[model samples]
Target: MYRYNDFDEAFVRERVAQFSGQVARRIDGSLTEEEFRPLRLMNGLYLQLHAYMLRVAIPYGTLSSRQMDQLAHIAETYDRGYGHFTTRQNIQYNWPKLPDVPAILSDLADVQMHAIQTSGNTIRNVTADHFAGASADEVADPRPIAELIRQWSTDHPEFQFLPRKFKIAVSGAEADRAVVRAHDIGLVLRERAGTLGAEIIVGGGLGRTPMVGKTLKDFVPLQDLLPYLEATVSVWNLLGRRDNKYKARIKITVHEHGIEEIRARVEERFAQVKPAFGGIDMEMLSEIEAHFAPPAFVTKPVDAYTRAHEADPVFRAWADTNLAAHKAEGYAIVTVSLKKPGQTPGDASADQMRALAQIARDFAHDELRISHEQNVILPHVHKSDLPAIHAALKAADLATANIGLVSDIIACPGMDYCALATARSIPVAQGIATRFNELKLEHEIGPLKIKISGCINACGHHHVGHIGILGLDRAGVENYQITLGGDGTETTVIGERTGPGFAYDEIVPAIERLIAAYLELRTGPEETFLQTYRRLGMDPFKTALYPEKDAKAGKEKAHAA
Candidate 1:
């Protein structure tokens, strides 16, 4: 994790003091809701359905146990007893009092954390693969680059305000766990000519106009990355649509103007500004890299772990599903699933947060990571500690053992919480998870990703889901639009929309029908729902979804009559 220096500390403290004064002015009637709106938003505070929600940035989703403890303390003291982890790997407290926000920010600053750039139309938190440092397949740790970007973008005078929110994600591993393709800017670390570089993918996003990013540059050398990134954002900042909020995202800009034109503009900007970098950014990156050095690992035998796995089926199942490939021998990246049946997806209670912090301190080399799917990861847990860690997590209800399964859903706070939402998403997610669990079909369904967004903003990443569900409003009635064949992986693809939307009541059964169709049509058990849907088209699933409609016209007429 990147520690805050004196400058960083002073900057945050000053921001906190500024917000504190703003809060006082609002309370004392000097600032009206209209006047105070942007100020609050800039500080990562939002007035949601029932209360004020405070979103705190977990930069690149990396945190120390002490930082986790601070978050837990904030949750306990300032807001509700629990916090919601979002798809961007940030955490949101849905019930913070307006007056206490500055205090909350102060607590976060105490731990070298803040809510800056977690919201608003500025460069949002720069995310990366949760398993960046620990993943065995990684070419390099993406955190150093992520941190560099973070420093460059934080309160960046040039980019303080953009047409819309900007997001950047970096991935060093072969698997795109960071969902880079769905971001405004995506960087894939690669090696070329025996030197490290990045494949820059730009203008990808997942709002109403979802798009997989186009490759702007095949290989940008390490030295040129910051300049290139600055150029890219500068181009978008100057030329991106400002007339309409919906059209303002770089995704639409890229869609409207061809990638070649955008590339040309970025190149021109880069050529002009590249000289200003003067290699200082590289030295800063190297300093950041020094902070992220890997922790020492013990050469421990895993015979005990093998014996435990052989003895306990439940532990074995958990190990198989939740453990990811680790870079160190006998070490595993453990994903703690937040998706327990009937619970709000991506929510962790204060106690659960504290417990996870304890686990990180005791067993995970004091390193904790938050995955983009809204789960926590203990990035360097020894295999021998698996049994104990599993037991503790199971006690906290964090060990659901559903990593990529159907039950591991990503959902947004819909009508139940989000004022912008027209339809509910959380309940629908719970319904699907509960129905699947009741049917005992989750395991049989195999690896499947189902993402639900409350609205077209695509906060839950519905566009990249293998099965995407978007909640919508149709003449004041709740409805859902389904999209299939989407994937959030290295081979990223935005889901294609199926015809018309379904009624809210009919969505769960519709999803069940889709899964059942996949089961029936799949060539083998190894084929995932997305794979099957890609091989075969929507027609097969459409038939299953509307069996009565698929019948003859006469039969349909008879039934209707």
Candidate 2:
């Protein structure tokens, strides 16, 4: 939770005033839709299929309870009753009126938040591990570096308009919760010989062309990160394609020119820019680090927590699924699930947001985090507070014990909201979650990630799900394609597609068949779907998906042989 200084306060207020005038001009016909597109996009406003959507950045996914309350207020007053949390750890208000955007932004500014750089073909929100300071296995908190990058990149003269939007993710933990491999620039903090630095991974992205980022620099000292990043983005900004918007991303640039050449160019540019950074970045990072110091953890008995776990099966189930080990002795990290059965994957109602805020204030350390998995996190909840927190969440309908389960899916706002989508995604996700819940096999099925995207944009990150579902329009009918064995972790891999697409009506049953096949093929109940898929490969799942075709092909191959 980095608090805004005097300069930050003035800067954001100035930008709000600037955008307010821009908005007025658009409404007054001084600026047409064509003219206002870039300006509005720069402010994180989008004209969606039905209404305008505003994406507000949650830097490093950290928020104070006060800030959370402000967001809830914005949702209740300006937009609809709920807000959608995105895969980037940002939040979207889908029903804001054109005239009310400035007011909404003003409210955000009051809370030291803004929508700048959340959209546009510039460096979007700099994301980090949601459990940055609270996780037990972290080398160090990555938020200070993330904040430094944010301050440096916001309104940088050289990078205001790149060839395409760029993303950067940082993770400090041994486990890759941030999915850094799928970003344009992924930084994994590492310590060698008692000194901290980062391992840089470049060119990773997912869309029509999915790639796991290749290692660019094995280790870069913390002090030199900014200069090195400047080198990387400057090289791509100039070399990336401008002719076709589709191929304008830095990922495409890295694909065309190998990593070696890119490294050479970046090194050449690094020498030129390294002098300008002359320790100011380090000074600022030091200042930013102070704002992120860990909360004073209180020592408390866990007798109540143990009793609740032993006595109440419901509380125990929720705790087992939703809780993670914290760095502090008595504290635990709690993930508040937004993917309740049949609801949108990442949406939180205004009341739910308020409830979470109150719970954070009372039971937690007044801190909240938005995980990239589309869930809210109370990162410093004492174990003794678990029973009360669980009761409050249950009252708000936020007590779903499905974290990392089959029903806890990640899906994008497809044809329902996005204009670029070719088919519907929300309904498909709802159908899948509801179907699995009805079957009561989610816990039995074990940990699984099912990501869905309405199109090739891969906003839902389907390319990295254990079971990836991509919805497309096949001859005006909705069709879904499946990819298996995709993972977004330290050992990241793009999913492999199973043969053909299934009709919308057939997609859920097709998923069921795949799961059934996995259960049968696994060595035992402990072997998860992903493990079975990796051990046995896609042939079995494909055969399950297209039984008649697989059998016919097998007979044809036998006859030919």
Candidate 3:
């Protein structure tokens, strides 16, 4: 919601001009691909398997109606007619011409958006809770802090080329919707003694070495936040491994050097850095906070929503799945599902974008949010507008009553698009969603998260799913590995892998068997898969995954008995 000031506008314009020149040189063969790789990457351009992919950052995942219109325009004009929303709360264009990327950036600049730092080994987009300003449970909105960090880190000379890409996420609520623990720097907003501060976490990451971040500081006063973060990442930028790409993430560095040592070093560095800040960061934050003030609320009766829920079972089901509690009276946060059955997860067409923009403008206060789950959010919709919003979504094929159900899967553009991927992720996710839809058991399963990644690089965040599926090319065959009991919430943990990987064709049935086991093993439906898994541990799910082993054990037990 923060509009670009004149300086911000000039900065983006210069970046676009520079990148346009670089791209033109590359096209003319004056600069080879090898020479242009880093430059292109810094601008969020990647050469995928088939074409160039452009990732545009949605800072803090907040969007205005005008920005949404610009995005739709980009989808229709530049690349394909659709864009893929990523788990990082960004959007990607899989097919774009080399010459047109500059134009794309210009269009984004028109709406106060950009692709800078969306890629490269620099500080990426600073993400925050999608419901930051509206969540009923929030202590304070964290996007102002996220936006502050974004301003500080963009093209920061010291961190432009670190050991690896660094990510930061902020969680404003008690529920941890932003997966703060899985980030390089995770900040949890809290207040004590009438003073606002953050619980600072460091060295958490997924990819090859999965780690839940350790508490770097129990509380960093809001004034001292940027200084503390600078010291932390600066330490990692120096101490992190540059020799091995696989071990370059801060998580690996934290693993190699104990958290205590890292903490001591960071503290020493913070001591030096703290004085230089002199509270300017806090001054900036006060200004940023004003931009995120809650929209003006209009009192409205919920009679229409109650009537629709009572009269129409379909509307009731959708309302139940798609809505979240809002801080304001007579308001609800509506999640528009992108994971419709048999469709690629998170692919939104130009028409869908425009429709969502219209919904945000007419019903929700001209505001929209992109969620880390790859869904669209209308954060301040009146309860009375629920039926109309649902109807519009239904007409656009966006109304899928499956937000936290098994069918609401998070998947990456695996081998289908990413050259780094070893196997395809989209097909596997689609197969699982289609299978579960046919079984009609997803709603019964209740709040199951299935995340699929193409490789160990975890673009889909597979390590944090309740049921995680990792696709790999094993000896020339596509193999799928399953991990159970993973969570990406306030209680974050990396999932445990089941015994062996399954073939591409066998993965769907394997998931089905695991769900069936949970259905039978649970004490009641109220106990979700995660709770039952925690209660019963891995034996049940592991046995279900490997039926042959289960049968062999069963036969041996019978003989012994």
**Model 3 vs. true fold: TM:** 0.98
> Can you list the residue pairs that collide in candidate 3?
none
Cα lDDT tens digits, model 2, 1-561, are 799999999999999999999999999999999999999999999999999999999999999999999999999999888999999999999999999999999999999999999999999999999989999999999999999999999999999999999999999988999999999999999999998999999999999889999899999999899999999999999999999998998888898999999999999999999999999999999999999888888997999999999999999999999999998998899999999999999999999999999999998889999988899999999999999999999999999999999989999999999988988899999999999999999998999999999999999999999999999998999999999999998989999999789998999999999898887899988999889988888888888999989789899999999
Error of 3 at 390 (Å): 0.7
Clashes of each: 0, 0, 0
Residue 141, candidate 1: alpha-carbon lDDT: 95
Q: What is the lDDT of candidate 1?
A: 0.92
Q: What digit string (tens of lDDT, one per residue) describes model 1 on residues 372-443?
A: 998999999899999999999988878898899998999999989998998899999999999998998787
What range of 10 consecutive residues in model 2 has the weakest lDDT sum? 533-542
Model 2 / residue 426 / CA error / Å = 0.6
Model 3 CA deviation exceeding 4 Å by range: 554-561
lDDT of 2 at 82: 92
Q: Give the per-residue Cα lDDT of candidate 2 at 371.
A: 88
Candidate 2 residue pairs that clash: none
lDDT of 3 by residue, 157-179 (tens): 99999999999999989999999
lDDT of each: 0.92, 0.94, 0.93
